[model samples]
Target: MAKNMTLLWCTGSCPCWRAMIALEEKNLQGYNHQLLSFDKMEHKSQQVLDINPRGQFPTFKHGDNVVNESYAICFYLESQFKSQGNKLIPDGPEEQALMYQRMFEGLTFYDKLGNVIYYDWYVPEGERHDSALKRNKDALVAELGLWEGYLSKQGSGSFLAGKTFSLADVVVFPTVAFLFRFGLSAGRYPKLEEYYALLKDRPSIKASRPPHWLEGPEEELLLKEI
Candidate 1:
């Protein structure tokens, strides 16, 4: 039986986007989500804070167990709903290791790019530092190179870890899609252009692509569309 589960989520945030993609990939159907509002500070209210004292969105509530971190929440969903569609991480050591390795590498890119993308785009002009932006962009460039190398070696045939579409694809593709479509795209990388184009065609991703909105009802609807 599917547990009575609900995700306290955020729209437009990369971390929340990750959870959405993970849920789709696993095909763990039927659970609803409560999309919280950052503008209204709903995440900090007593209702949400009671479940997640850290006041973070994309928090997962499964009966008594609560998961806060995006990555950990995905893991928890996969573990609890193991009988669902796709296995984000396989059971065998060798196979599971490959999934973890690519997924973790994807997280590294999230960290490197997040510093610039989140701060430069979101932070107030006065609060954002030029030096920090440059350094973070540089780090993202380096990480992109690493991804290019990995793709050239592995993402050629079907997926990142060779033949099977695993957690890595779910974790990496959305950011890649955003980067290419809106932001830098292919400022410094050639291999990524071809790779991302192919990945954007994935049905799960195409179905999950969020619509743009400012805040409140419109933004909440966009997230539910995913």
Candidate 2:
């Protein structure tokens, strides 16, 4: 009811960004936000540990109710503050189901992309498996196309959930953003390219972009151009 929300998150964490976007989307103002650092192990501090034993980022506290995990925090905010700004979960049963389905699909898409990033880029050259890398790259390309197709099916809408920017967009935005950061081009997925451009300037998105991304050099890309 009051502006008593507090968020503890790490920079560049996609899950943390999800909570930040949800808060901004709700137009919930003046909430306390603390930036933690993984490099410094700030999340493992006693204060954070007391609230969240796992010491994970995207820790949320609404008065006395504490919630950790990105999706859980986002859902908690959406359900508790539905009267505020844009409705994230949507109203109808079918639309709600679709939003949930698409949101999880976003996770699958990220897992596919993550495999490529981990094996091809993060792993040492000698340690990386060529067969696995190739498989991941192919899977990433296919996953990107699946999202492109979802956008195409929207016809007039620019968002994945149709007409409005829902939880589906919030869930998928970071994955795509990560792809872009890793030098994947949106050029091949025309519909996704358009949708990508559309979300770039959203107030919540602009506010929630990883701060280090502004200061750091772009990561070396691994996925071949599709």
Model 2, range 1-226, lDDT digits (tens) per residue? 3368888889888888888888889887579888989789988988789889998887789999998877887788889988888889878887778889999888898789778776644677787777877877888888887887887887744578767789988878887777777777766767766776889779999988999998975766665374
The TM-scores, one per candidate, come to 0.80, 0.89
Candidate 1: which stretches are off by over 4 Å? Answer: 1-3, 91-94, 120-128, 213-226
List the lowest-lDDT window of 10 residues for candidate 2: 217-226
Clash tally for model 2? 0
